[model samples]
Target: MNPEIYSLFDEPHADNEYTYRHNIGVGIIATYLGMKLGLSKENLSALTLAAMLHDVGKTRISDNIVEKPGKLNEAEYEDMKRHAIYGYELLKNIPGIPPSIALTALQHHEREDGQGYPQGKSGKDINLHAKIVAIADVFHAMSSSSGYAVL
Candidate 1:
């Protein structure tokens, strides 16, 4: 892993661990699915990297909101939703990072039904890589034994 990428996981904040594990698990699952789907090596690598960093924006959000034990009020939830765009902004200026990769961070929260936040993109408006990362992210969050059951 690149030093910069590795640094993202160096500090394991109690609240952020769920986000970290969720992103990593998405990468792993996407890689496996990419192989099964016969994706090219370059494509697979891009998807994996995108998946791993999809929630990097959450690093900028408040732990009080992210790790809250109870349901979030509407305003709080909206604030929490901004992480996707925030993550994209953080990755956008990084030298050599592809636009597609940055977009995954921004678009993973998007739903097929156009109900997602940060951008209400629907169907083909969402990039294919983002779609793949979204599927992997959902799968990991649902299948894991962690307390993300309420998500």
Candidate 2:
């Protein structure tokens, strides 16, 4: 594997180790979930890459919003949510990137109940890989933030 590919993750703020860790953790978990869901090996590989880069758009966000220690105000939160669209644009522009990868970046925040942001896509409207990455992302975020072993 090319180390250059991984170096992209390091492009984000070095002080935000949690974001880096979250990306890697979600990648592993999402790939595992994909495998368990009977994805082909090619699909699993794409899932791993997609999950790791799912939050790449956060780089486009301001440090004030992304690194804030307190809850965001309504306007700030709206701006923060643009990271999804940013991520999609970033990945989709890269030559040879898979459609699933860009879609996952854009749609991972989507919910089955259609309450998610960037787009109100619900249920089947969301890509399967995006759905799996969403679950893995939440699990990892909760476990890492709470220091608990999720069952």
Best by lDDT: 2
RMSD of each: 2.3, 3.4
Best by TM-score: 2
Off by over 4 Å in 2: 1-7, 146-151
Q: For residue 133, what is the lDDT in candidate 1?
A: 83
Kindly state the number of residue pairs that clash in model 1.
0
Model 1's TM-score against the true structure: 0.87
Task: State the weakest 10-residue window (summed lDDT) of model 1.
Answer: 6-15
For each candidate in turn, the TM-score is 0.87, 0.90
Q: How accurate is candidate 2 locally (lDDT)?
A: 0.82
- Give per-residue CA lDDT, model 1, range 21-72, as digits (tens): 7767888998898888898888888788888888778777788887787788
Full-model lDDT for every candidate: 0.78, 0.82
Pairs that clash in candidate 2: none
